[model samples]
Target: MTITPQWKDELRARITLSSVIMRTDKLTKAGREWKGCCPFHDEKTPSFYVNDQKQFYHCFGCGAHGDVISWMTEQRGLSFIDAIKELAAEAGMEVPAPDPVAAKRAEKRAELIDVTTEAQDWFVEQLRGSAGREALAYLNRRGLKPETLREFGFGYSPESKQALPTALPRFEDHMLVEAGMRIRTDDGTTYDRFRGRVMLPIQDARGRVIAFGGRILENRDGVAKYLNSPDTPLFDKGRTLYNLHRASPASRQTGRVVVVEGYMDVVALAQAGIKDAVAPLGTALTEMQLEMLWRMVEVPVLCFDGDAAGQRAAMRAISRALPMLAPMRSLSIVRLPSGMDPDDLINDRGVGAMEKLLAEPKSLLDTLWEFERDAMPLESPEAKAGLKKRLMEHVDTIGDPDIQSLYRRDLLDRFSAFAYPPRQQAKRGPWRGPAAAPKTLSNGARSTLQKSMSGGQRSDLLGAVIAGLVRHPGEISRHSEALIELARHDQSAAPAIESLIELAETLDSRIQTAISAEQGFPAPPVDNRYAFLREGTPPGEAREELAEAVSLLAHKPALEAAMAATIARFDEDPEGSFAEQARLRQQLMTVDERLKAFGRKKAGSDTARDENSVSSDS
Candidate 1:
C-alpha cells in the first residue's frame, strides 16, 4: 500500500517531535528548541536540538537530522513502514487504503499547487513591471523596503479580467479557476479573482504557495478593502494563517508567535523587525489556526487593533480559544491603544514600544475578566449578577476540568472583591459624652486585657507574623480564611493583616521579588520566639513556625472574647457563669502552653545543631 504525502503530513503535524525524542534523550528547553547531549554521538557539551515548530531534530556534533519518523527509523532501527504504522497508532490516524481515485485527487492537488505558484510568479513580475507602478508606489508609501517586498513575495494583479489567461495561455481556464486565480460567473464568463490590488502569497507549512491575499492600492467607493482566495483544493482560509511559513521559523528564534488582525498588520510588524507574526485570513481565528499557532509556541500573543472592532475581534478569538486551552498551552492578548494599530504604533513610537506591549500581553483569563467587568455598568445588583453569569458562561466553555475550575475560582474571587469590597472603618473625632466612673475589674480579666494590649503595642508575635507574611506573600492565600477570622476578632491588628492579604492578592512574581529585596516591613523583634523571622531561615521551617504563630495569634482573640462574655453573664447566672469562666480560663492556659511549646522547640533544635557542630569540630 502506497502512503500518500498528505497522510504523512497529517501524522507528523499531530505528533510533537520533542515528545517522541525525549523518550530516548533527555532534553532541556533552550529557547524555542530543546537541547541535550547527542544520542548518536558521545559528547560532554550538549549540542543536539529538537524543534517542535519545525517538527525536526538535528545534532551539531553528529550531524543527525530527521523528523519524528526518521528519528524512529534511525534510533530504534525500525523500518520506514514500521515507523509509520507505530506513529499512525499513536496519533490515532488510520492508514489510507490503496485507491486509484484518491491517487488521482492527490495528483490534481499537486497540479493546483503548480498553478498557484505560477500565478504567484506572474503577479510578482507584474509588480516589477510598468503595470505595477501604482502598486509599487503604494507599497513604498507604506514604508516597505525593497528587500521586505521581495522577501514577502509582494506582487500586483492587473485590472484586466483576461490577464492571467493571456499570460499563461497553455493552461486551461478551468485549472485557473480551480486554483482560485480566476472566478467563473453564472453565465460561463471567467475573470481574475484578485484584480488591481497589492498581492500577498499565502503558503503552507512547506513554503508552497497555496493562495493569494489582495489589498486595494487605493480605497474606492464600492471596492472591498481586502480580498482573499476563496476555498480551493489547496487553501482553506479558516485552516491557514497568513504568514505561517515565515513566522514558524521566526517564532522558533523569538520563543513567541504573535497573531495580528490582517496581513497588513503582519507586514507592518515584520517591517518593524518583528518577524514572528501572523494573522487569520479575513476571518476570526479558528480552532485549527490556534492549534497551528500553539505548535510553534506555548503561548502565542494575540495583538489586535486598538479600536472597537479590534476589541470585538479579540473577544471572538478569546471565545474560540477558551474551550481548546490546556495546561501550558494558551494565548496572551496585546490590546493596542484606542485608534491605533501595529503600523500606527510603530510609526508613532518605535519598535521598543511595540516590544514592550507584546512582552506584557494580558493572560487569557485576565483579558476575559477585564472585558466582562467593564462590558457594561455594574452599578446595580442586577448588572453585577449579569457580569457574574457572563463570566461563568465563558468558564463553562473550557474543556479542561482543572483549567475550568481554576478560571471559575479566579473570576469569582475578583467578582467578590469587586461587588463586596471591604468596609472601611469610620474615623473617630473627639469624645462627645461625659466620662463615667470606672468600675473595678477582676485581677485575671485585667491581666488578660493588659496582655492583649501589650501584644498589640509591642511588635512581638503580631509583628513577626506580619513580617513572615511579607517575606512569603504567596502563603497568604493558604491562610486567607484564618486571616479573615483573625481580622474579625482582633481590631487592633486587623488593619495591617487585612492590608497584607490585599497586597498579596495583587502581588505577581516581579512585585513579590521587589518587596522581598526591599525589606518592605520592619525587622521582627530579636526575641528567640520570633526566630522564624531571622534571615537564612529555610522556607519549610519558616512556614511551619509562621503557621504556629498565626494560630496562637488567632486563638488569643477568641479566648479573650469568650472570657469577657462569660464575665458579663456573672450578674444574671452566678453559678453557671463561674463554671463557664473556669472552663475559659483552662482554655486560655492551654493556649499559653502551646505558645511556650513553640519557643521550647526552637530552642531545643538550635541547641542540638550547636552540639552537633561542636562534636564535628572536635
Candidate 2:
C-alpha cells in the first residue's frame, strides 16, 4: 500500500497518542499531557510524556520518542505494514490501495537519494585529489580546518561537464539528472550541473544527502557566486534548510537554533564551535522553512548580515511570520556588524562577537518597530503616519486574536512614544502629600488632596469622572490607559488619577468610608448628571455610566486625534480613509450622545449628599 503524507497525517489525526500509550503503560494527567514511566526503559520515576494535541509521545529517560505509528512499530516490534494495518483498524480508517504512480515516485526518490550520495562521495574524492588544488587553497584561505570541512561534508566539483556522469557510471544519465546532479538540456546534451566550486551537501533530517550547494572558487564575470540544486522528487530547496540534519539534534540539546543566511554561513558558525546553526538556501526564508525551524525552537534566532540586504531579509522573515504567530512562538533577530557576514566577523574580530550577538537578539516586536520606524525619512507628519499604517497592516495579518490585539496596542503605543517624545522635565523628589494633610486620612486621599487644594483647575466632566473612580476604586486598572492619557493632557487631574492607580489594590470600595470620611474627595460638579453619583443607583448601572463618563472625559479626545490622523491619509487611500473617517465620526457622536444623556438629567437629590462633605469643610 502506498501511504501519502496526507494519508499518514489523517491516520495520525484520527488516533490520540496518549490513549494508545495508556493501553500498555499507566499514565497520569500532567497538565495538557499524560505522564508516566517510559515503556522503553525501566524506571521508578516517570520520564515519558504524551500530548494528544501534538499526537506524539516523548521520553526524557532513554530518548524514546515517536508518533502513534512509531509507537506501534518500534515499541511493539511490529512491521511497518502491520503497524499501519493495526492503527488503521483501530482508527476506523481504510488503508489506501497501492498507487502505481505513487509507488514509482517513491522508488524514484529512493534511487535519487542513492545517486546524490554517490555524487557526494565522488565530489569529496575529487576534493582530496589533484583536481581540487585550487578549491583546497580557497578553503585554506577561508581558514577552514580539515575537521570542519570533513564534518560539513565539504567537497569539490571539477570544471569538466562530464565529471559526475563519468564518476557515477552505475546510475543512468536520466537518474543523475532527476537527482539534480547533472543537467540534460532540450538538445539531448547532458553535463554536470555544478562546476569549479566548493560543494556542501544538504541533507534531510535523517542525514541522507538530498541536495548540493556550491560556492564558486573563481570570481568570473556573469557567473553567479553561489548555486544550489534544483527541486527534484527528493529535494525542495524552499522546504529544506542546509545542515538541518545536524542542527536538529544540536538544537534539542541546546534548546536553541541559530538561522543564518546561507549554507556557507552555517558552516562558518559550526566551525566557530556553534553547532546548532542552519540556513535557508539562496531564496528568502519561506513559511515552510519557518515551520521547520519552529519545530525545533519556539523562537529561532535569525542571524543575518548587518548590511541593507540582511535587514531587508530579516524584515521579510518577520512579515511572513506575523500572520502565523502563536503564543510563545516567534522569532528573534541578530544583525551582524556592518560590512560583515558571520565569516567576516569571526575572522576580523573573533567568534566571541558572533556568540554574543546570538546570545542576545532583538525581539520580533522590537525588530519590527525598529525596522519600520527607520525605514524612511519621517520628516513629515504624513510620513510618520505611513509608518503606522505599515505597522497595522502587519498587525491585521496575525491569525490569533489575543496576539493580534497585543501587537496592535504595543505597536501603536510605541508609535505614539516615537512620534510624540515625552518632554524633558527637571528631576524632582518623589511625590508626597501636602504638609497640612490630616494625619488619619488615607494615603491616596491625602495625595489627591494636594491637586485639589493647590488651586489647580478641574473641568466639570473631569471632576465627575474622578468622583466615579473614587466610588469605584476597583475599576481603576480597567481604564488605566484612558486615565493615564487624561493625566498626560490635563495636569490638574494627574495627581488624583495617578494616586488612584497606586491605591487600586489597597483602597476600600466604600466611597463614604474611604475618602469622604475626611472630606478629601471631590463632589460632583454642579449641573453634573453622571448616573454614578446618584443615590439608589444599582452597582451595575453606576459602573456602566461611570465607564461612559470616563470614556467621554478621557478617550474621546484620543478618538478625535485618531480620526484626524485617518483624515491625513485621505489622499493616499481615499476609500479606506473615508470609510475609517466615517466610522470614527460615528463613534465620536455615539460617545457625545451618551454623555449628553447624562447631562440632560437634572442635578438629582444625590448632589445634596455630595454637598454634605464639601459644604461642611468649606
**lDDT, each prediction:** 0.78, 0.77
lDDT of 1: 0.78
RMSD (Cα, Å) for all candidates, in order, is 18.5, 16.9
Candidate whose TM-score is highest: 1
Candidate 1 lDDT at 374 equals 87
lDDT, model 2: 0.77
In the range 264-313, model 2's lDDT, one tens digit per residue, is 88888888889999999888889999977875666899998999999999
Alpha-carbon runs more than 4 Å astray in model 2: 1-98, 423-618
Against the correct fold, how does model 1 do in TM-score? 0.61
Worst 10 residues of 2 by lDDT: 508-517
